[model samples]
Target: MNEVGVIDWGIVGAGHIAHRFAQGLAHVRDARLARVWSRRTESVAAFVQRHGGEGCGSFDDLLASDIDAVYIATLNDSHAGYARAALAAGKHVLCEKPATLNAGELRAVLETARVSRRLFMEAMKPPFFPLYRTLCEHLRRDPIGPVGLVRAGCSVANVPAEHPSFSLDTGGGALLDIGVYEMFLAVDWLGAPLDVQTFGRIGASGVDTFASVHSRHEAGIAQLFCGLDLDGKGDALLAGPHGYVWIHEKWWNPVRATVSYAGGRVVELNVPFEGGGLNYETAHFCELIRAGELESPIMTHEKSLRMISMLDAARSALGLVFPGE
Candidate 1:
């Protein structure tokens, strides 16, 4: 409850991503870690001890604490529930990607946030980064000279059965976990597609292990693939008549890019930063909350809903049905 000149933040869920967000907070001038809450009391206590913050025993206590915002880093299934509770309690919210299990859930959360007049934003990570902004600018300048096709993919070794990434009931799958990155970029660059065709191979747990999707935009097309059954270096390419931009390891905080064209010409761009790239999203969240804005022009609510709808269609095409849904 101390009056610091920064946005007081309480982090919910003590996971790997939560730690990254905490570390990223050090670089954000307008936000500070005020408290932490987790089902594992001892773990939350340890997090507070190490991070110089307080540990609360329950979500009620954390929400009632002197924090301006609640960062929900819990499992995907828990996002909507926690965010709704936070918004109802008069607090801003920054939730992790796949903010909800489906478009319906996203709609429900947005409706609740709207009714409560509170700010709610998803932590998609890439759109808020500097490199993506720069890339958008170049593309707008016709650097690519009329994009013809976009091919993007993200695939990694399957998670162990014990890992949360393998749980279907918790909304675990390549699409929500990693495919959204490629999908978001495609939509951001080319807008919604006229049609979407998808093919996926589901795991024994009823989650899609691999998905190959084609989005046909009016102007061009986006060919995207994501999987847990294969391991390959991920890249996103925006191709055009004149040149193409290549983003390496595009999903996990891209640091370098290459633009290549005919005549063996290549231009490499380096994205510089002071600390962890996670600062981008956190900083953007602070700005929006400080300005009393509910929606972001860059990462709009409509975009989130549309992306979820695409996933819904893809699931229907692949015959994927979550448990108890």
Candidate 2:
């Protein structure tokens, strides 16, 4: 950060999620994408042209640039490497999703952040959304008692077989690509997983096509699922002794929810988001940068590790292992 309090950002990938980040950055105050790098020069050029950032020829160039933070928006397998490199370069890292392939890899990445004394966070966007925030506050004022059971899942059949999400070499699977989100919700609400029981199918691409996971957490139990070749669907439920909260379809990107009480009263929450929804997390990251914080209170390192550990266990149960893991 300069004297003006502006945070210069470097992006490691120029894919769909990166584009969403660039769009969301416009809404964050005093944060700008100063540099961007990807595997393809043409993709970098196109991204820079639209997002107004300097195109770097290599990942090293992006790291060497005078940027305050690096957003790792690459594929699942490469997230750990980019995060480690950026943090070692003395740059704060906001990695997309699962953070790393497994618990061991995430532990290594977290250690790097500690040694480098830089902020590191996984870009989990749900809890930062307006509706989620509202739900928390509402539950705090009223009483939902202790949330014990969380049920959430998402499945989609629109993705073609050629999509990177089904490629084994890239570490793409419904478990990591889609189930990670559900895992986050489970851990966030129910606590760390105690045991994960999974059943799924492996596709011809050598990745998981679908998975149904039943996890017992410290607080309660959660039932979650994810799929790449199924119909597009989902909703989430948080059940407690008093009542339950129902997050409408596509709960991960939640906008509306219904809170019911045992007293026969219902509360509806609807808080629409702006800037394509990624801005909430990006803005939170910027706030962390300005505060000189090493970790986010909401999306803590422990929560990330717990989420990935569930993914690891689920994958192991289904006999779905990546190439190098």
lDDT of each: 0.83, 0.93
TM-scores for every candidate against the unseen true structure = 0.94, 0.99
In candidate 1, which residue ranges exceed 4 Å CA deviation? 1-5, 262-264
Q: Which digits, one per residue and each the tens of the lDDT, describe model 2 over residues 1-325? A: 7647899999999999999999999999899989999999999999999999899999999898899999999998999999999999999999999799899999999999999999999999999999999998999999789999999999999998789998899899999999999999999999989999999999998999999999999999999999998985689999999999999987988899999999999999999999999999989998988898999999999999999899999999999888888
Question: Per-residue lDDT for 256-290 in model 1, tens only?
Answer: 77888765688777776555777788888888877
Q: What is the clash count of model 2?
A: 0
Q: Which pairs of residues have clashing backbones in candidate 1?
A: none
What RMSD, rounded to one decimal, does every model reach? 1.9, 0.8
